[model samples]
Target chain A: MSVDVLINEVGPRDGLQSQGKTLTVGQRAELIGALVDAGISAIEAGSFVSPKAVPQMAGTNELYALLPAAEHVAYSALVPNMRGYDLAVAAGARTVNVVLSATETMNQKNIRMSLEQTTSVCAEIMQRCRQDGINGQAYVAVAFSCPFEGETSQSVVRSLSDRMMEAGAGKVIIADTIGAANPRQVTGLMHDLVGSISAERLSCHFHDTRGMALANVLAALNEGVREFDSSIGGLGGCPFSPGASGNLATEDLALMLESMGMDIGFAAQRLVPVVRTAERLTGITLGGHSFRWLARQVESEEQGGGA
Target chain B: MSVDVLINEVGPRDGLQSQGKTLTVGQRAELIGALVDAGISAIEAGSFVSPKAVPQMAGTNELYALLPAAEHVAYSALVPNMRGYDLAVAAGARTVNVVLSATETMNQKNIRMSLEQTTSVCAEIMQRCRQDGINGQAYVAVAFSCPFEGETSQSVVRSLSDRMMEAGAGKVIIADTIGAANPRQVTGLMHDLVGSISAERLSCHFHDTRGMALANVLAALNEGVREFDSSIGGLGGCPFSPGASGNLATEDLALMLESMGMDIGFAAQRLVPVVRTAERLTGITLGGHSFRWLARQVESEEQGGGA
Candidate 1:
């Protein structure tokens, strides 16, 4: 049942950020604690960003401070710039994720920086992470299609990925931020990326906005890229992208992968309680495609011993 | 732009039959008319089952009578048995869909018959359709997993498919009736099915229960399946299967296929209005994965010339 795949849980960071209400430091720690209990080893706990800009992530450092460090568990934080990276490092973050949009328009809109400035910023972040002995994962946002820029060229994404790697990023995550990627586009990009960058160093981050996240995941899996970023209860969406939906639901992805006989290293049944906790905290009826079905299974189990 | 794929619209039959309120025959006809106008040619217009058994599908004949016939547009009806077949033919149905469960438990529960009895009934119905010069599509429901029986055997599905084809079924649709199929299972079954049956004579019907329907479609497409059954606005789910979600949303499928540059004949843009109409009629917000994104595109077009 060991399927050699890494499910990097991003719910604590990505899932909670876009919500209307913010979870207290204790509440965020509880959610992350539940995920670790459910056997999710890797978690993006929070981001080191301006509280004035993203107030939801204000107490990230305290949230991390309160967390119980465990064996086989890795915690990472998103660092937007040099200051964010410095803050993350000071907060005892051992791994940092730096993001830059793939297209010029998105880079400008999302980070208020030109593509050149964003890449330069990313390179500096990656170099700092390398110098500080922190694992650096760089993200190419809107890797498939930008909300403002119709289609992103593979060449552009490829060059940016190359630059991030050259600048000492340990891994690169290709993100369909707008959730607009289809399987074929995913295949085309992954096919090229896998050839140029080792599959071990490449991952996929997708939103379920267009309901193609899992499909795109399958495409990446076929290309031998095994690492993926998912959120609990299908939380997270790019605030800048109009009509964008949530991130690929962790429970949904777990169900598909487990059904396919891939050992995702966590019990899908165990994630149900985690999702329920998320729903209670967010006060949103949180679910992915498998949410209802899983709930039914849980109910059946309660009524009849097991699903 | 000419990618060959048959999108068999199943909204009128499958979509409506599962709703809380049944649309009037006039309302059903108008929906079908709108679909036809949107350039969808194959529609499962209604069912010929006992109205007492499935009151939602009552007055199907009248619904058919109200439909406008057009060149290249084929209207089919779901016929449960010889009686339903005869009724469908009398109502001028050119094509008929006969369904048989792949599992013994489902067969007994759904139709109050054993597997042997159901196949015999299907053979008789297929023979009748052949005699009446009607095209017949046989469905192997719960082909992947049954709610009561759990995992359905591939051999059981294979043998039933062979018998249906031998009994004069023009095509056999492999349905993940309870929406329990993942891509690997789909690929395994399709890999074997395609070897035994020509790809042209094989189609796939999937539900998005686990959000893997489109991924399953991708698997089938890789195995050379060009025909798919989709409900407009993701409107159908099996009433027998507790907590089952809707059929693979036509808009979602069309978006994926069309984005891959496949000529799905109809534009994804046109399906937006149809989905809006479906929402209006069902008194439910209907959408696929790309529903919100597509709606935004339509809105932008209205404001700024056209998309």
Candidate 2:
């Protein structure tokens, strides 16, 4: 199939999980509902992780129970191991995204497993996903650069990505966990990745830590990779990666894409209010320099001033 | 001369001028001193606008008097008109930057003059600069999009840029006053402008309000336009164009440029402390997602865990 751009809203999962605050299952359901209304067709609803580590993602099953099923929207949960996969499947999650690191150091630091062990665990999860008839999306975190292991090699990224693709995984997401990838690196790696793997079955997950998420997205877009993962108000920072910021703000990414004449279904204008809500919810102000300017443009237009 | 990169540090002038609370002369001098020590060769030290309109910039002459004279550092000030130019020259400013709007509505809102009137005034200022042997740079604010006039055409930008270049402007910096210009539009316009004008004589000042400043910079860099105006820690907002945040952060821009193997002298590692000091002085967050990440990277390396 041709590359069809997909925006996977990870607000409810990656966003809330990053913040120390925990929301009730009902709140996660409501946030998901808001996203569905906003025309986001795919969402990483929740992550099945140890509550000891991330309390916000504790009641993933309960949140899944509360989610309103829609025909168009594909809701997925992050499953780290076979146990997480089983739990996600039992919660009626049709899609499960398994994550592993390419480097031994990062794999050890993130999940206390070596690269080989992590890959083996992911293979088991992928087998479980295939047995349960659930679509498995594997993500190789720190595909670009790692805090524990700097300068993640493109060959390693490609090797792991190929492994996941062969292991009954329906798709793969390349994540720059530490936000260290520049445009040249992104363009070069993406060009190679897309040539080897179908860009349609690939997604790019970026952290805005280095302020290069949007630029990286543009690079991937040029390479014909359609799917992207962004958090509302840029609310998701990596727990393992110290000082790394959240994903790219959905509003900011949508604005850039829409301005470039790429038809992302979400309306960039409507997202300003939601970003304000997110800002109020979390005192951390998100977005690049243009957030307030675009807000003013929308506000002035509403006030009948063509600003 | 070989390819030289000019970084016009605007934090002191454009940044402090827009804030509600004005800094003392000592504090302003300290800020400039820090930037100069950090290897910024050109600093927009202050603006000679009216105290009533811009109270923060009232001590332009005081700041100029105390500035440490260095052979490499070129101190400039904003000159709105002939009176402003005279004040700037009297204050010992060797380089004065003049501002004029391309559209009539913006000109009316900004300085209460028609485009023709503004052009005539700018021409007089240019003639005075020529006679006085002072370098005058013209900034075409709202060159990409006008808040009051809506979409600003490329023809207007080209016309204004050509006139400014012809009128003794050593360099003409194009301001995205409302932060609405995307990569394609900026690239396309720069392509057109570069054909008529040397990229060396051009600079781009972009606001990150739409999260496209870095991408826009990448586009301009690819076009061979090296000179750029950025605020330290992303200080300053467009006072005339409300809701537009600070120009792209100097550290962020330097980080990208340095990583790309481009020889821009400002070190991204050294800029963090400068940003922290500025943020403390200004009482406004010098915000960027990458700031903390960079700090952590440094700290981790210090702890023997290289990032």
Candidate 3:
């Protein structure tokens, strides 16, 4: 197993943020701790945002305070603006992820800002991260294709990624916010991204809305992306984006990665119990077909070839 | 738009094969006709296998005979044996597909044969296909991972693919039979494939079980594979493979391809109606997330507001 890949778990932040029943600060911390125990190195802990805008991520600062401090285990907080960044830093988040869309339509819909304005704000946050000795990851949301906008151009996506890189971002996450991208688009954009930025400095975030997130990731991976963002048990969706399914499931992605002999330092089978817990807590279906099948498989295995 | 993509619609053969309700010969022809009307040039019409094993694909010769002999349509059948190939030839099949597993366990369970025996049979069939002026395509099942035996090696996958290419096969389809592959695996395999064979000769068949089918396709597309197998409304799963979901949806793949500005000659909006028809016919949910989302989007557009 090649220990070259970074599996950035996003279930705590992206997954829980979608559930209507928000986990308390302690629960969030526990979840993060569980992820750490499961051998995940990087984790998106929570987003520093207004409770009014995103109630689920309200107590992220408190949750971050409870987390065990470790050098190898990097906990990241999502921030949209300077205020969010300041809150993230105050909460002891050494890694901060700032997100903006590549298209104007998504920028307006997601954050109520223009692309230029979002880029400027992200740049400011990047500068802050650099000064504070924190790692900054810029999430290029809707980098593939936007729900509001029909298709995002490769040139626009590349420009946003380049700006984020220029702004001192440690890594740029090319996100398929709506899961509307095909392999060609993923490869094309990643090609443009790698041309300006190093492949090691790129990450991928994908939604399984149209069930192409992993495929998009593969396309990007072919272009040399090593880091990926995935939710545990597929417990995520954009609350703002009504029809989205979820982020690529962390366990499932890890399973695929490990099965391919890529060292992601995680076991998918070990995470099943956590998935069940999340499902019980949320009362929402996690992965539609795969999870149920996995449950039956384990049950059948335990039954020992029962009729 | 690059007009180079060849979408081999497997809805009739693969999609219906896994469904509960078996369409009659006429109904199957009508469905294939609808796909032809939608401008899909290549199609896997049916599989010539044992009636008991795959009742839905029974009497494939009858269905093949019933299909419209359009000049543009490249009607084909999945041949399991020399007898099946003879039946397909008698039915005027211009193209034939043969399946082989990269893993020994899968080949043993699926075809009850060793990998060597399966490869040898496929080779013989390919030779026969050449003599009969048929374009023979070999599908490397479990190319990424096997259900019974997990984590298929790249060497095993590549050797099988190489054998298929040497067997006078016109095209080779690398299938993630159990949907146990990630983007990294997909790209890594495609990288190997592209180096050894022409991209034009390679195709991909993916299942959406773990929701990486499209991502795998994207990676394959990045490596220059233009041909792909997709089921209409994402209908079809390997009955032998436990917990497997259907093939990558034709409409969804079309959507992503078109969104990327590559011309596969599929209209997602037009395909929605056919998908609905398929759901009605099969009494199985197909494209539940995407179809519902697309319908609402269209309805909202028609109403001049959010639906």
Candidate 4:
């Protein structure tokens, strides 16, 4: 891992897609604007999918047109299939991410396909990204544990990741779909992945379900993976996983990295206001586990008792 | 680190001592009994202090007598001075712990002693334990940060830990008195500590104030710490630190260690009800961040949905 790390904020996409209330395309742009102001360099802007399946992601093409500072920010979009990918590329999305579950049952439940079929579809999309010169990413969802299957096979994940890479995917993010990953599990799996794929092309997506997300992050960091996916104010959870909690909170991740003296570019203390803004936009009371302490720091600084 | 880790429950002492309400000796013993039934082996039963100073620890001597399974379970008490030490030994306490703050201002505010004076007193107590054939322990409180003093010196902590060991203390616990520790900080300090003093003779006490307690635990474990101090239901905080939250919750630590494939000597799922009993006893709502998921696991198991 380098001294500087990458923070990929996914609030506008992964976070909002699961919310009960759908945000207007305008309000979604406003949230992205606030994130850019908070110094988030990379973000998952929205998804290109059927509005009927995910109503919250309606009008993503319009939202992309209204995003702030297109020249400075690295904004990506999620695409479920070839049609979604075409729509995303047409909307001028330079980066696109795809999801492939490691287990057959999870693939059936999440996207209504078999594991093999999902892999084929994702592989085709990655090849298309290479042809189109788009920065392509793939998420190995439920990579650690499955609600339907107890423990996912590491060999299967490795093979799937290798196929994605061979198909021209730029990165593979190991996601804890049910947030059932432990540090030991992370260390064991990440050790294998980093050895096979090299660290620069790997990232991690964790949920705080069992409250081990940060610990798991440390484990992955120890294994040389740096880039991480998180949502502002810990905005979302898996719709299919019953006991799974929110995605690892952006402020918590930033605060931890800042505290460690690592460089993530943005000042974590400033993200407090962005969390409040996201809460207002979504009508969901949201805060990371460290929200209280982080707010107190911001308050103390406001009172001129600077840290 | 060993495959098996020791969970040192400090709820009855460090947890209760900071509470607003004081439980009767009988109530305290009942809480200890509940933890014992849940498979906790080592517990800080209470402190031998002036009742006027800390009313919650008023009947520690009486509580000691009512403890269950004296031979099977290991019970330790905190002693502030020679008088408290004499009382603890008189009450049949075989193990006693002493606290030494790592900062001067903390020592002044906590025990009305200078850091040098406090160290000397703790050294005397530890020496006394050696003469009396007792298992002696010392806590380097505020080893990470002091409330009045921002960041503590690592060299000072190392020196204090060394002195405690030299003074015949069986173990020295590195305490994050205000919960301002990060995993990187933990890794740096523990690397020094584990080198100076062997891992088997060291312990860690953390608070969840900034929500990185588990991450810090992982860092310490990486540096070979096998013993940790946590409280049931995250019962208490340092009465002196403004933003310091509760001690690391016993269930959270146990669950993380167990999930990491380590042997922590008990089923973490069994501690959910124990947290409930603690909340009822303390009249404060308490749960670790993972409490909801843990409770769900217990419920699933009760319904005979075997994992």
> Using lDDT as the measure, which candidate wins?
4
Model 1 per-residue lDDT tens digits across residues B1-307 = 1348989999999989988888988889988988998888789999999889888899998888888788778888999888898888888888999999998889898778999999999999998878878999899999999989999999999999999999999999999988889999999999999999889999999999777999999999989999999999888784434334578989988888888788888898899999988888878767886788888788888999965
User: What is the per-residue lDDT of model 1 for residues A1-307, given as tens digits with 9 covering 90 to 100?
Assistant: 1347889999999888888899898999999999999999889999999999999999788887987688788899999999999888888999999998988988788778899999999999999888889999999998989889799989999999999999999999999987878899999999999999999999999888877888889999999999899998787774424324579989988888888988888878788999899988878767777877787778888999854
lDDT of 4 by residue, B83-179 (tens): 9999999998999999999999999997789999999999999999999999999999999888899999999999999999999999999999888
What is candidate 1's local distance difference test score?
0.88
Q: In DockQ, how does model 4 score against the reference complex?
A: 0.55
Docking class of 4: medium
lDDT of 3 by residue, A1-307 (tens): 1366788888888888878788878878777777777777888989999999888899888887788776678888999888888888887888999998888877787778988998899999998898889999999888767778778888887888888888889999988887666666777888888878988898888777655666566667668888888887777774434434667777767766665567777655566666776666666656533555455565776689743
TM-score of each: 0.95, 0.88, 0.84, 0.96
| Stretches of model 2 off by over 4 angstroms after superposition | A1-4, A49-55, A123-133, A238-244, A272-307, B1-5, B51-53, B127-133, B238-244, B294-307
Candidate 1's displacement at residue B136, Å, is 1.5
Q: Check candidate 2 and list the clashing pairs.
A: A236-A246, A289-B208, A289-B209, A290-B208, A290-B209, A290-B210, A291-B209
Which one wins by DockQ: 1 or 3? Answer: 1
List candidate 3 stretches off by more than 4 Å: A1-3, A68-71, A80-82, A101-120, A144-168, A238-244, A288-307, B1-3, B100-128, B140-169, B180-202, B238-244, B288-307
- Best-fitting candidate, scored by DockQ: 1
Model 4 stretches astray by more than 4 angstroms: A1-3, A238-244, A305-307, B1-3, B238-245, B305-307
> How badly does each model clash, as a count of residue pairs?
0, 7, 7, 0
- Poorest lDDT segment (10 consecutive residues) of candidate 4 chain B: B237-246
Worst ten-residue run, lDDT, model 3 chain A?
A237-246
Structural RMSD, model 2: 3.7
Q: Score candidate 1 by TM-score against the native.
A: 0.95
How high is the DockQ of candidate 3?
0.37
Q: Write down the lDDT of every candidate, Cα atoms only.
A: 0.88, 0.81, 0.79, 0.91
